[model samples]
Target chain A: MPRKTTIIGILGILLYIVGCYDGLLVAPADRFMGDIQRIMYVHVPCAWNTLVCFTISLVAALGWLLSGARARAEGRAWKWDELLEATTEIGVVLGAFLVVQGMLWAKPTWGVYWTWDPRLTTVAVMELMFVAVLALRGFVDEPVRRATWSAVVTLVAYVNVPLVYFSVKWWASLHQVQSSPSTVDPAMVLPLRINAFAVLFMSIGLMGLRTQLARRQRQALLGESDSDSTASSGGAA
Target chain B: MTGVMQGHFDTVLWVYGLTTAGLLGYFATLLLRLRASKAPTSGQTRVSAQNPEKTS
Candidate 1:
Protein backbone atom coordinates (compact mmCIF):
# COMPACT_ATOMS: atom_id res chain seq x y z
CA MET A 1 0.00 0.00 0.00
CA PRO A 2 2.95 2.30 0.53
CA ARG A 3 4.25 4.29 -2.43
CA LYS A 4 7.68 2.73 -2.15
CA THR A 5 6.26 -0.77 -2.18
CA THR A 6 4.22 -0.12 -5.31
CA ILE A 7 7.20 1.41 -7.05
CA ILE A 8 9.42 -1.55 -6.30
CA GLY A 9 6.73 -4.03 -7.33
CA ILE A 10 6.09 -2.31 -10.64
CA LEU A 11 9.83 -2.00 -11.19
CA GLY A 12 10.13 -5.70 -10.59
CA ILE A 13 7.47 -6.43 -13.17
CA LEU A 14 9.37 -4.31 -15.66
CA LEU A 15 12.59 -6.11 -14.90
CA TYR A 16 10.89 -9.46 -15.23
CA ILE A 17 9.70 -8.48 -18.68
CA VAL A 18 13.19 -7.44 -19.73
CA GLY A 19 14.75 -10.50 -18.19
CA CYS A 20 12.33 -12.77 -19.99
CA TYR A 21 13.07 -11.02 -23.25
CA ASP A 22 16.79 -11.47 -22.81
CA GLY A 23 16.42 -15.13 -21.97
CA LEU A 24 14.02 -15.87 -24.77
CA LEU A 25 15.77 -13.96 -27.53
CA VAL A 26 19.26 -12.82 -26.57
CA ALA A 27 20.59 -15.73 -24.63
CA PRO A 28 21.79 -18.67 -26.63
CA ALA A 29 19.76 -21.85 -26.47
CA ASP A 30 21.19 -24.91 -24.79
CA ARG A 31 22.86 -27.19 -27.31
CA PHE A 32 21.29 -30.19 -25.66
CA MET A 33 17.86 -29.00 -24.60
CA GLY A 34 17.56 -26.22 -27.17
CA ASP A 35 15.04 -23.45 -26.45
CA ILE A 36 13.59 -25.35 -23.55
CA GLN A 37 16.62 -24.25 -21.57
CA ARG A 38 15.14 -20.74 -21.57
CA ILE A 39 12.82 -21.92 -18.86
CA MET A 40 15.83 -21.86 -16.57
CA TYR A 41 15.72 -18.08 -16.44
CA VAL A 42 12.33 -17.97 -14.73
CA HIS A 43 12.65 -21.37 -13.04
CA VAL A 44 15.97 -20.65 -11.34
CA PRO A 45 14.85 -17.20 -10.26
CA CYS A 46 11.67 -18.60 -8.71
CA ALA A 47 13.70 -21.21 -6.84
CA TRP A 48 16.07 -18.61 -5.41
CA ASN A 49 13.24 -16.25 -4.48
CA THR A 50 11.26 -19.03 -2.83
CA LEU A 51 14.18 -19.85 -0.58
CA VAL A 52 14.74 -16.19 0.12
CA CYS A 53 11.12 -15.64 1.13
CA PHE A 54 11.15 -18.69 3.42
CA THR A 55 14.40 -17.49 4.94
CA ILE A 56 12.70 -14.20 5.71
CA SER A 57 9.87 -16.13 7.36
CA LEU A 58 12.41 -18.05 9.45
CA VAL A 59 14.04 -14.84 10.59
CA ALA A 60 10.65 -13.30 11.34
CA ALA A 61 9.76 -16.32 13.44
CA LEU A 62 12.95 -15.96 15.40
CA GLY A 63 12.26 -12.28 15.86
CA TRP A 64 8.82 -13.04 17.26
CA LEU A 65 10.16 -15.55 19.79
CA LEU A 66 13.37 -13.75 20.71
CA SER A 67 11.50 -10.52 21.33
CA GLY A 68 8.82 -12.26 23.29
CA ALA A 69 7.64 -11.21 26.81
CA ARG A 70 9.17 -7.75 26.87
CA ALA A 71 8.22 -7.02 23.30
CA ARG A 72 4.73 -8.33 23.96
CA ALA A 73 4.36 -6.06 26.95
CA GLU A 74 5.53 -3.15 24.87
CA GLY A 75 3.00 -4.11 22.16
CA ARG A 76 5.79 -4.42 19.59
CA ALA A 77 5.51 -8.11 18.83
CA TRP A 78 2.74 -7.80 16.26
CA LYS A 79 5.18 -6.35 13.77
CA TRP A 80 7.18 -9.54 13.73
CA ASP A 81 4.04 -11.66 13.61
CA GLU A 82 2.74 -9.65 10.70
CA LEU A 83 6.03 -10.13 8.90
CA LEU A 84 5.98 -13.87 9.54
CA GLU A 85 2.55 -14.23 7.98
CA ALA A 86 3.45 -12.05 5.02
CA THR A 87 6.66 -13.84 4.12
CA THR A 88 5.22 -17.29 4.63
CA GLU A 89 2.38 -16.53 2.21
CA ILE A 90 4.73 -15.15 -0.38
CA GLY A 91 7.08 -18.07 0.11
CA VAL A 92 4.29 -20.51 -0.58
CA VAL A 93 3.38 -18.72 -3.81
CA LEU A 94 6.97 -18.70 -5.03
CA GLY A 95 7.60 -22.30 -4.03
CA ALA A 96 4.53 -23.37 -5.96
CA PHE A 97 5.83 -21.45 -8.94
CA LEU A 98 9.22 -23.11 -8.56
CA VAL A 99 7.79 -26.62 -8.52
CA VAL A 100 5.54 -26.10 -11.53
CA GLN A 101 8.35 -24.51 -13.49
CA GLY A 102 10.63 -27.40 -12.63
CA MET A 103 8.00 -29.87 -13.70
CA LEU A 104 7.43 -28.10 -17.01
CA TRP A 105 11.13 -28.18 -17.75
CA ALA A 106 11.45 -31.77 -16.65
CA LYS A 107 8.75 -32.99 -19.02
CA PRO A 108 10.81 -32.25 -22.08
CA THR A 109 14.29 -32.79 -20.71
CA TRP A 110 13.76 -35.79 -18.44
CA GLY A 111 11.03 -37.58 -20.38
CA VAL A 112 8.49 -37.09 -17.61
CA TYR A 113 6.68 -34.30 -15.81
CA TRP A 114 7.18 -35.66 -12.31
CA THR A 115 10.18 -37.49 -10.94
CA TRP A 116 11.38 -38.71 -7.54
CA ASP A 117 14.65 -36.89 -7.90
CA PRO A 118 16.27 -35.95 -4.62
CA ARG A 119 16.27 -32.17 -5.02
CA LEU A 120 12.77 -32.24 -6.44
CA THR A 121 11.44 -34.41 -3.62
CA THR A 122 13.05 -32.30 -0.92
CA VAL A 123 11.69 -29.13 -2.51
CA ALA A 124 8.21 -30.64 -2.50
CA VAL A 125 8.55 -31.53 1.16
CA MET A 126 9.75 -28.03 1.96
CA GLU A 127 6.77 -26.45 0.17
CA LEU A 128 4.27 -28.72 1.91
CA MET A 129 5.76 -27.99 5.32
CA PHE A 130 5.50 -24.23 4.84
CA VAL A 131 1.98 -24.60 3.52
CA ALA A 132 1.07 -26.47 6.71
CA VAL A 133 2.33 -23.48 8.69
CA LEU A 134 -0.09 -21.25 6.79
CA ALA A 135 -2.91 -23.66 7.47
CA LEU A 136 -1.97 -23.70 11.17
CA ARG A 137 -2.36 -19.95 11.25
CA GLY A 138 -5.89 -20.20 9.80
CA PHE A 139 -6.95 -22.76 12.46
CA VAL A 140 -5.76 -20.73 15.46
CA ASP A 141 -7.96 -17.77 16.35
CA GLU A 142 -6.08 -16.03 19.14
CA PRO A 143 -3.53 -13.49 17.94
CA VAL A 144 -0.72 -14.42 20.32
CA ARG A 145 -1.31 -18.16 20.05
CA ARG A 146 -1.41 -18.12 16.26
CA ALA A 147 1.86 -16.21 16.12
CA THR A 148 3.55 -18.47 18.66
CA TRP A 149 2.43 -21.77 17.16
CA SER A 150 3.15 -20.80 13.57
CA ALA A 151 6.60 -19.58 14.56
CA VAL A 152 7.37 -22.89 16.24
CA VAL A 153 6.06 -24.86 13.29
CA THR A 154 8.10 -22.64 10.98
CA LEU A 155 11.18 -23.61 12.94
CA VAL A 156 10.39 -27.28 12.43
CA ALA A 157 9.70 -26.83 8.72
CA TYR A 158 12.92 -24.89 8.17
CA VAL A 159 14.95 -28.08 8.68
CA ASN A 160 14.09 -29.26 5.20
CA VAL A 161 15.08 -25.99 3.50
CA PRO A 162 18.77 -26.72 3.62
CA LEU A 163 18.15 -30.23 2.46
CA VAL A 164 16.39 -28.84 -0.61
CA TYR A 165 19.47 -26.87 -1.54
CA PHE A 166 21.91 -29.72 -0.93
CA SER A 167 19.81 -32.64 -2.08
CA VAL A 168 21.29 -32.72 -5.56
CA LYS A 169 24.84 -32.77 -4.29
CA TRP A 170 24.24 -35.31 -1.52
CA TRP A 171 22.42 -37.79 -3.72
CA ALA A 172 22.53 -39.22 -7.18
CA SER A 173 19.83 -37.45 -9.14
CA LEU A 174 18.76 -36.33 -12.59
CA HIS A 175 18.67 -32.73 -11.37
CA GLN A 176 21.84 -30.78 -11.83
CA VAL A 177 23.78 -29.42 -8.90
CA GLN A 178 23.51 -25.74 -8.08
CA SER A 179 24.24 -23.49 -11.00
CA SER A 180 27.01 -20.88 -10.89
CA PRO A 181 28.47 -18.41 -13.31
CA SER A 182 31.43 -20.72 -13.73
CA THR A 183 29.19 -23.68 -14.52
CA VAL A 184 26.61 -21.90 -16.66
CA ASP A 185 27.27 -19.94 -19.81
CA PRO A 186 28.24 -16.36 -19.05
CA ALA A 187 25.50 -15.00 -21.33
CA MET A 188 22.81 -16.99 -19.52
CA VAL A 189 23.95 -15.69 -16.16
CA LEU A 190 22.97 -12.07 -16.90
CA PRO A 191 19.28 -12.71 -17.52
CA LEU A 192 19.21 -15.28 -14.73
CA ARG A 193 20.67 -12.79 -12.30
CA ILE A 194 18.32 -10.10 -13.53
CA ASN A 195 15.30 -12.29 -12.87
CA ALA A 196 16.72 -13.20 -9.48
CA PHE A 197 16.90 -9.57 -8.41
CA ALA A 198 13.55 -8.85 -10.02
CA VAL A 199 11.86 -11.58 -8.05
CA LEU A 200 13.55 -10.39 -4.85
CA PHE A 201 12.26 -6.88 -5.37
CA MET A 202 8.78 -8.18 -6.06
CA SER A 203 8.85 -10.39 -2.97
CA ILE A 204 9.85 -7.51 -0.72
CA GLY A 205 7.09 -5.35 -2.17
CA LEU A 206 4.48 -8.07 -1.77
CA MET A 207 5.65 -8.80 1.77
CA GLY A 208 5.26 -5.17 2.73
CA LEU A 209 1.78 -4.98 1.26
CA ARG A 210 0.80 -8.22 3.00
CA THR A 211 2.17 -7.09 6.37
CA GLN A 212 0.24 -3.86 6.05
CA LEU A 213 -2.92 -5.82 5.33
CA ALA A 214 -2.37 -7.98 8.42
CA ARG A 215 -1.87 -4.93 10.60
CA ARG A 216 -5.11 -3.38 9.37
CA GLN A 217 -7.05 -6.60 9.87
CA ARG A 218 -5.71 -7.03 13.41
CA GLN A 219 -6.50 -3.45 14.29
CA ALA A 220 -10.06 -3.92 13.05
CA LEU A 221 -10.47 -7.10 15.12
CA LEU A 222 -9.11 -5.45 18.22
CA GLY A 223 -11.41 -2.51 17.71
CA GLU A 224 -14.44 -4.77 17.44
CA SER A 225 -13.44 -6.71 20.55
CA ASP A 226 -12.97 -3.47 22.50
CA SER A 227 -16.42 -2.18 21.49
CA ASP A 228 -18.07 -5.50 22.38
CA SER A 229 -16.45 -5.55 25.85
CA THR A 230 -17.36 -1.90 26.45
CA ALA A 231 -20.98 -2.54 25.44
CA SER A 232 -21.29 -5.51 27.84
CA SER A 233 -19.82 -3.49 30.69
CA GLY A 234 -22.22 -0.61 29.92
CA GLY A 235 -25.19 -2.98 29.92
CA ALA A 236 -24.12 -4.37 33.31
CA ALA A 237 -23.81 -0.83 34.71
CA MET B 1 17.05 -40.77 -24.96
CA THR B 2 15.43 -38.88 -27.81
CA GLY B 3 13.02 -37.11 -25.48
CA VAL B 4 15.33 -34.12 -25.15
CA MET B 5 15.48 -33.81 -28.90
CA GLN B 6 11.78 -33.04 -29.44
CA GLY B 7 9.95 -29.73 -29.72
CA HIS B 8 9.88 -28.04 -26.34
CA PHE B 9 8.75 -24.53 -27.16
CA ASP B 10 5.32 -25.24 -25.73
CA THR B 11 6.84 -26.39 -22.47
CA VAL B 12 8.86 -23.21 -22.16
CA LEU B 13 5.83 -21.11 -22.97
CA TRP B 14 3.74 -22.90 -20.39
CA VAL B 15 6.34 -22.38 -17.69
CA TYR B 16 6.54 -18.65 -18.23
CA GLY B 17 2.81 -18.27 -18.73
CA LEU B 18 1.83 -20.15 -15.60
CA THR B 19 4.37 -18.45 -13.33
CA THR B 20 3.52 -14.98 -14.56
CA ALA B 21 -0.17 -15.63 -14.22
CA GLY B 22 0.19 -17.17 -10.76
CA LEU B 23 2.26 -14.34 -9.31
CA LEU B 24 0.03 -11.70 -10.82
CA GLY B 25 -3.05 -13.45 -9.49
CA TYR B 26 -1.53 -13.46 -6.03
CA PHE B 27 -0.70 -9.78 -6.24
CA ALA B 28 -4.22 -8.96 -7.36
CA THR B 29 -5.67 -10.91 -4.47
CA LEU B 30 -3.43 -9.11 -2.01
CA LEU B 31 -4.53 -5.77 -3.38
CA LEU B 32 -8.16 -6.76 -3.18
CA ARG B 33 -7.74 -7.95 0.41
CA LEU B 34 -6.08 -4.71 1.35
CA ARG B 35 -8.96 -2.79 -0.12
CA ALA B 36 -11.43 -5.01 1.70
CA SER B 37 -9.68 -4.47 5.00
CA LYS B 38 -9.78 -0.73 4.50
CA ALA B 39 -13.49 -0.83 3.75
CA PRO B 40 -15.54 0.17 6.80
CA THR B 41 -18.21 -2.33 7.79
CA SER B 42 -20.92 -2.43 10.50
CA GLY B 43 -20.34 -6.02 11.58
CA GLN B 44 -16.55 -5.66 11.44
CA THR B 45 -16.03 -9.13 12.87
CA ARG B 46 -17.38 -10.70 9.72
CA VAL B 47 -14.57 -9.12 7.74
CA SER B 48 -12.02 -11.75 8.65
CA ALA B 49 -14.19 -14.76 7.85
CA GLN B 50 -15.27 -13.42 4.48
CA ASN B 51 -12.21 -11.49 3.35
CA PRO B 52 -9.39 -12.93 1.29
CA GLU B 53 -6.39 -12.18 3.50
CA LYS B 54 -8.02 -13.78 6.53
CA THR B 55 -5.00 -13.00 8.72
CA SER B 56 -7.17 -13.18 11.81
Candidate 2:
Protein backbone atom coordinates (compact mmCIF):
# COMPACT_ATOMS: atom_id res chain seq x y z
CA MET A 1 0.00 0.00 0.00
CA PRO A 2 2.84 2.40 0.83
CA ARG A 3 4.54 1.61 -2.47
CA LYS A 4 1.29 2.11 -4.30
CA THR A 5 0.71 5.43 -2.54
CA THR A 6 4.20 6.61 -3.44
CA ILE A 7 3.63 5.72 -7.08
CA ILE A 8 0.32 7.51 -7.04
CA GLY A 9 1.95 10.54 -5.42
CA ILE A 10 4.61 10.65 -8.11
CA LEU A 11 2.06 10.32 -10.86
CA GLY A 12 -0.14 12.96 -9.22
CA ILE A 13 2.70 15.50 -9.12
CA LEU A 14 3.70 14.87 -12.71
CA LEU A 15 0.16 15.11 -13.96
CA TYR A 16 -0.53 18.24 -11.96
CA ILE A 17 2.53 19.98 -13.38
CA VAL A 18 1.57 18.99 -16.88
CA GLY A 19 -1.98 20.05 -16.16
CA CYS A 20 -0.95 23.50 -14.92
CA TYR A 21 1.21 24.03 -17.97
CA ASP A 22 -1.67 23.03 -20.20
CA GLY A 23 -4.09 25.31 -18.38
CA LEU A 24 -1.86 28.36 -18.20
CA LEU A 25 0.61 28.08 -21.05
CA VAL A 26 -1.16 26.19 -23.80
CA ALA A 27 -4.88 26.90 -23.51
CA PRO A 28 -6.48 30.18 -24.50
CA ALA A 29 -8.83 31.96 -22.10
CA ASP A 30 -12.61 31.85 -22.54
CA ARG A 31 -14.22 34.67 -24.50
CA PHE A 32 -17.09 34.93 -22.04
CA MET A 33 -15.52 34.62 -18.56
CA GLY A 34 -11.94 35.07 -19.77
CA ASP A 35 -9.36 34.09 -17.09
CA ILE A 36 -12.12 33.25 -14.66
CA GLN A 37 -13.24 30.34 -16.80
CA ARG A 38 -9.97 28.70 -15.78
CA ILE A 39 -11.46 28.42 -12.34
CA MET A 40 -13.79 25.72 -13.65
CA TYR A 41 -10.84 23.42 -14.17
CA VAL A 42 -10.23 23.37 -10.43
CA HIS A 43 -13.64 24.22 -9.00
CA VAL A 44 -15.69 21.74 -11.01
CA PRO A 45 -13.33 18.87 -10.30
CA CYS A 46 -13.33 19.47 -6.57
CA ALA A 47 -17.11 19.48 -6.53
CA TRP A 48 -17.30 16.25 -8.52
CA ASN A 49 -14.74 14.43 -6.37
CA THR A 50 -16.41 15.58 -3.17
CA LEU A 51 -19.69 14.07 -4.34
CA VAL A 52 -17.88 10.92 -5.40
CA CYS A 53 -16.27 10.57 -1.96
CA PHE A 54 -19.57 10.93 -0.17
CA THR A 55 -21.22 8.32 -2.38
CA ILE A 56 -18.40 5.85 -1.77
CA SER A 57 -18.66 6.47 1.95
CA LEU A 58 -22.37 5.72 1.88
CA VAL A 59 -21.84 2.46 0.05
CA ALA A 60 -19.01 1.46 2.36
CA ALA A 61 -21.11 2.12 5.43
CA LEU A 62 -23.95 -0.04 4.09
CA GLY A 63 -21.49 -2.75 3.14
CA TRP A 64 -20.03 -2.65 6.63
CA LEU A 65 -23.40 -3.07 8.30
CA LEU A 66 -24.41 -5.96 6.06
CA SER A 67 -21.05 -7.68 6.28
CA GLY A 68 -20.92 -7.25 10.05
CA ALA A 69 -24.30 -8.90 10.48
CA ARG A 70 -23.24 -11.75 8.23
CA ALA A 71 -19.93 -12.09 10.05
CA ARG A 72 -21.74 -12.42 13.33
CA ALA A 73 -24.24 -14.94 11.97
CA GLU A 74 -21.58 -17.01 10.22
CA GLY A 75 -19.02 -16.47 13.02
CA ARG A 76 -16.47 -15.48 10.37
CA ALA A 77 -15.38 -12.24 12.13
CA TRP A 78 -14.86 -9.45 9.61
CA LYS A 79 -13.17 -6.03 10.07
CA TRP A 80 -15.96 -3.93 8.73
CA ASP A 81 -15.47 -1.50 11.61
CA GLU A 82 -12.09 -0.40 10.27
CA LEU A 83 -13.53 -0.10 6.79
CA LEU A 84 -16.33 2.13 8.08
CA GLU A 85 -13.95 4.40 9.96
CA ALA A 86 -11.65 4.77 6.97
CA THR A 87 -14.49 5.55 4.62
CA THR A 88 -16.04 8.11 6.98
CA GLU A 89 -12.74 9.88 7.57
CA ILE A 90 -12.18 10.13 3.85
CA GLY A 91 -15.69 11.39 3.31
CA VAL A 92 -15.43 14.17 5.90
CA VAL A 93 -12.09 15.52 4.71
CA LEU A 94 -13.10 15.58 1.08
CA GLY A 95 -16.50 17.03 1.97
CA ALA A 96 -14.90 19.90 3.86
CA PHE A 97 -12.47 20.61 1.04
CA LEU A 98 -15.35 20.63 -1.41
CA VAL A 99 -17.20 23.35 0.46
CA VAL A 100 -14.15 25.50 0.84
CA GLN A 101 -13.50 25.28 -2.87
CA GLY A 102 -17.15 25.88 -3.67
CA MET A 103 -17.28 28.97 -1.51
CA LEU A 104 -14.23 30.22 -3.31
CA TRP A 105 -15.91 29.61 -6.64
CA ALA A 106 -19.21 31.02 -5.49
CA LYS A 107 -17.91 34.27 -4.08
CA PRO A 108 -16.76 35.26 -7.54
CA THR A 109 -19.53 33.84 -9.71
CA TRP A 110 -22.47 34.69 -7.49
CA GLY A 111 -21.12 37.94 -5.99
CA VAL A 112 -21.33 36.53 -2.52
CA TYR A 113 -19.63 33.89 -0.40
CA TRP A 114 -22.97 32.41 0.68
CA THR A 115 -26.56 33.08 -0.33
CA TRP A 116 -28.99 30.45 0.98
CA ASP A 117 -29.17 28.63 -2.34
CA PRO A 118 -30.81 25.22 -2.07
CA ARG A 119 -27.87 23.21 -3.37
CA LEU A 120 -25.35 25.07 -1.25
CA THR A 121 -27.51 24.87 1.85
CA THR A 122 -28.19 21.17 1.39
CA VAL A 123 -24.54 20.36 0.82
CA ALA A 124 -23.57 22.31 3.90
CA VAL A 125 -26.08 20.31 5.89
CA MET A 126 -24.70 17.09 4.51
CA GLU A 127 -21.20 18.18 5.48
CA LEU A 128 -22.42 18.93 8.99
CA MET A 129 -23.99 15.48 9.25
CA PHE A 130 -20.62 13.99 8.40
CA VAL A 131 -19.07 16.02 11.19
CA ALA A 132 -21.75 14.73 13.53
CA VAL A 133 -20.85 11.16 12.63
CA LEU A 134 -17.23 11.84 13.57
CA ALA A 135 -18.30 13.52 16.80
CA LEU A 136 -20.51 10.54 17.63
CA ARG A 137 -17.56 8.23 17.13
CA GLY A 138 -15.46 10.41 19.44
CA PHE A 139 -18.07 10.31 22.21
CA VAL A 140 -18.54 6.54 22.11
CA ASP A 141 -15.68 4.61 23.62
CA GLU A 142 -16.89 1.10 22.92
CA PRO A 143 -15.63 -0.21 19.56
CA VAL A 144 -18.64 -2.19 18.37
CA ARG A 145 -21.17 0.44 19.34
CA ARG A 146 -19.17 3.26 17.76
CA ALA A 147 -18.80 1.43 14.47
CA THR A 148 -22.47 0.39 14.33
CA TRP A 149 -23.82 3.83 15.15
CA SER A 150 -21.47 5.63 12.77
CA ALA A 151 -22.42 3.29 9.98
CA VAL A 152 -26.04 4.16 10.63
CA VAL A 153 -25.37 7.92 10.54
CA THR A 154 -23.38 7.63 7.32
CA LEU A 155 -26.14 5.65 5.65
CA VAL A 156 -28.85 8.08 6.71
CA ALA A 157 -26.95 11.25 5.90
CA TYR A 158 -26.33 9.91 2.40
CA VAL A 159 -29.91 10.72 1.38
CA ASN A 160 -29.02 14.41 1.44
CA VAL A 161 -26.35 14.09 -1.27
CA PRO A 162 -28.90 13.60 -4.06
CA LEU A 163 -30.95 16.44 -2.66
CA VAL A 164 -27.91 18.68 -2.83
CA TYR A 165 -27.14 17.66 -6.39
CA PHE A 166 -30.70 18.03 -7.65
CA SER A 167 -31.59 21.19 -5.74
CA VAL A 168 -30.54 23.61 -8.49
CA LYS A 169 -32.39 21.63 -11.13
CA TRP A 170 -35.55 21.43 -9.05
CA TRP A 171 -35.73 25.07 -8.00
CA ALA A 172 -34.82 28.62 -9.01
CA SER A 173 -31.19 29.25 -8.18
CA LEU A 174 -27.98 31.08 -9.08
CA HIS A 175 -25.92 27.91 -9.26
CA GLN A 176 -25.14 26.85 -12.80
CA VAL A 177 -26.26 23.54 -14.19
CA GLN A 178 -23.50 21.08 -14.94
CA SER A 179 -21.65 21.82 -18.16
CA SER A 180 -22.13 19.40 -21.01
CA PRO A 181 -18.90 17.52 -21.50
CA SER A 182 -19.71 16.93 -25.17
CA THR A 183 -19.96 20.62 -25.85
CA VAL A 184 -16.95 21.77 -23.82
CA ASP A 185 -14.18 23.12 -26.01
CA PRO A 186 -11.15 20.83 -26.15
CA ALA A 187 -8.72 23.52 -24.97
CA MET A 188 -10.76 24.19 -21.82
CA VAL A 189 -11.82 20.60 -21.19
CA LEU A 190 -8.33 19.13 -21.33
CA PRO A 191 -7.03 20.91 -18.23
CA LEU A 192 -10.29 20.25 -16.45
CA ARG A 193 -9.94 16.52 -17.07
CA ILE A 194 -6.32 16.48 -15.95
CA ASN A 195 -7.16 18.42 -12.80
CA ALA A 196 -9.95 15.97 -12.01
CA PHE A 197 -7.60 13.01 -12.30
CA ALA A 198 -4.95 14.74 -10.15
CA VAL A 199 -7.42 15.66 -7.43
CA LEU A 200 -8.99 12.19 -7.46
CA PHE A 201 -5.65 10.46 -7.04
CA MET A 202 -4.65 12.92 -4.34
CA SER A 203 -7.94 12.41 -2.50
CA ILE A 204 -7.60 8.63 -2.60
CA GLY A 205 -4.00 8.79 -1.48
CA LEU A 206 -4.87 10.96 1.53
CA MET A 207 -7.72 8.61 2.41
CA GLY A 208 -5.45 5.60 2.26
CA LEU A 209 -2.98 7.29 4.58
CA ARG A 210 -5.78 8.35 6.94
CA THR A 211 -7.17 4.80 7.03
CA GLN A 212 -3.79 3.41 8.06
CA LEU A 213 -3.37 6.12 10.68
CA ALA A 214 -6.85 5.53 12.06
CA ARG A 215 -6.11 1.80 12.18
CA ARG A 216 -2.92 2.49 14.09
CA GLN A 217 -4.74 4.72 16.57
CA ARG A 218 -7.35 2.01 17.03
CA GLN A 219 -4.66 -0.56 17.79
CA ALA A 220 -3.06 1.72 20.38
CA LEU A 221 -6.39 2.17 22.17
CA LEU A 222 -6.89 -1.60 22.27
CA GLY A 223 -3.50 -1.96 24.05
CA GLU A 224 -2.12 -4.10 21.26
CA SER A 225 1.45 -4.40 20.00
CA ASP A 226 2.51 -1.93 17.33
CA SER A 227 2.87 -4.67 14.72
CA ASP A 228 0.79 -4.47 11.55
CA SER A 229 -0.69 -7.91 12.30
CA THR A 230 -2.73 -6.50 15.17
CA ALA A 231 -6.41 -6.74 14.39
CA SER A 232 -8.26 -3.49 13.56
CA SER A 233 -11.73 -2.93 14.95
CA GLY A 234 -13.45 0.13 16.43
CA GLY A 235 -10.86 2.55 17.88
CA ALA A 236 -12.19 6.00 17.00
CA ALA A 237 -13.19 6.95 20.53
CA MET B 1 -17.57 48.60 -21.65
CA THR B 2 -17.14 49.78 -18.07
CA GLY B 3 -20.22 47.93 -16.78
CA VAL B 4 -19.35 44.66 -18.51
CA MET B 5 -15.73 44.83 -17.35
CA GLN B 6 -16.76 45.47 -13.73
CA GLY B 7 -19.11 42.50 -13.83
CA HIS B 8 -16.30 40.09 -14.68
CA PHE B 9 -13.65 41.68 -12.48
CA ASP B 10 -15.05 40.80 -9.07
CA THR B 11 -15.97 37.33 -10.18
CA VAL B 12 -12.54 36.74 -11.60
CA LEU B 13 -10.85 37.92 -8.42
CA TRP B 14 -13.16 35.85 -6.24
CA VAL B 15 -12.56 32.65 -8.19
CA TYR B 16 -8.81 33.03 -8.28
CA GLY B 17 -8.57 33.95 -4.61
CA LEU B 18 -10.79 31.12 -3.41
CA THR B 19 -9.19 28.47 -5.54
CA THR B 20 -5.71 29.57 -4.53
CA ALA B 21 -6.67 29.50 -0.87
CA GLY B 22 -8.23 26.06 -1.18
CA LEU B 23 -5.19 24.62 -2.90
CA LEU B 24 -2.91 26.26 -0.37
CA GLY B 25 -4.88 24.85 2.55
CA TYR B 26 -4.60 21.34 1.21
CA PHE B 27 -0.88 21.75 0.59
CA ALA B 28 -0.37 23.14 4.09
CA THR B 29 -2.15 20.16 5.63
CA LEU B 30 0.05 17.71 3.77
CA LEU B 31 3.16 19.56 4.93
CA LEU B 32 1.98 19.61 8.53
CA ARG B 33 1.34 15.87 8.50
CA LEU B 34 4.71 15.21 6.97
CA ARG B 35 6.31 17.27 9.70
CA ALA B 36 4.40 15.40 12.40
CA SER B 37 5.42 11.99 11.05
CA LYS B 38 9.07 12.99 11.17
CA ALA B 39 8.94 14.35 14.73
CA PRO B 40 8.65 11.04 16.58
CA THR B 41 11.45 9.37 14.65
CA SER B 42 13.72 12.38 15.18
CA GLY B 43 12.85 12.49 18.88
CA GLN B 44 13.60 8.79 19.29
CA THR B 45 17.02 9.27 17.74
CA ARG B 46 17.79 12.14 20.10
CA VAL B 47 16.61 10.15 23.11
CA SER B 48 18.78 7.15 22.23
CA ALA B 49 21.86 9.24 21.66
CA GLN B 50 21.37 11.19 24.87
CA ASN B 51 20.92 8.04 26.95
CA PRO B 52 22.90 5.31 25.27
CA GLU B 53 23.38 3.71 28.73
CA LYS B 54 19.60 3.18 28.92
CA THR B 55 19.59 1.09 25.72
CA SER B 56 18.72 -2.48 26.58
DockQ for every model comes to 0.32, 0.16
Q: Is the docking of candidate 1 incorrect, acceptable, medium or high quality?
A: acceptable
Q: lDDT tens digits, residues A97-162, model 1?
A: 888888888876778989888998999999999999999999986677787899999999999999
Q: Can you tell me which runs of candidate 2 are displaced by over 4 Å?
A: A69-79, A225-237, B2-56
Clashing pairs in 1: none
Candidate 1: stretches off by over 4 Å:
A224-237, B1-6, B39-56
Over the full model, what C-alpha lDDT does candidate 2 score relative to the true structure? 0.65
Model 1 DockQ reads: 0.32
Chain A TM-score from candidate 1:
0.92
Docking class of 2: incorrect
How would you encode candidate 2's per-residue C-alpha lDDT over A83-160 as one tens digit per residue?
Answer: 566556666766676676577666655778788888789878988988888899899876667767888998888889
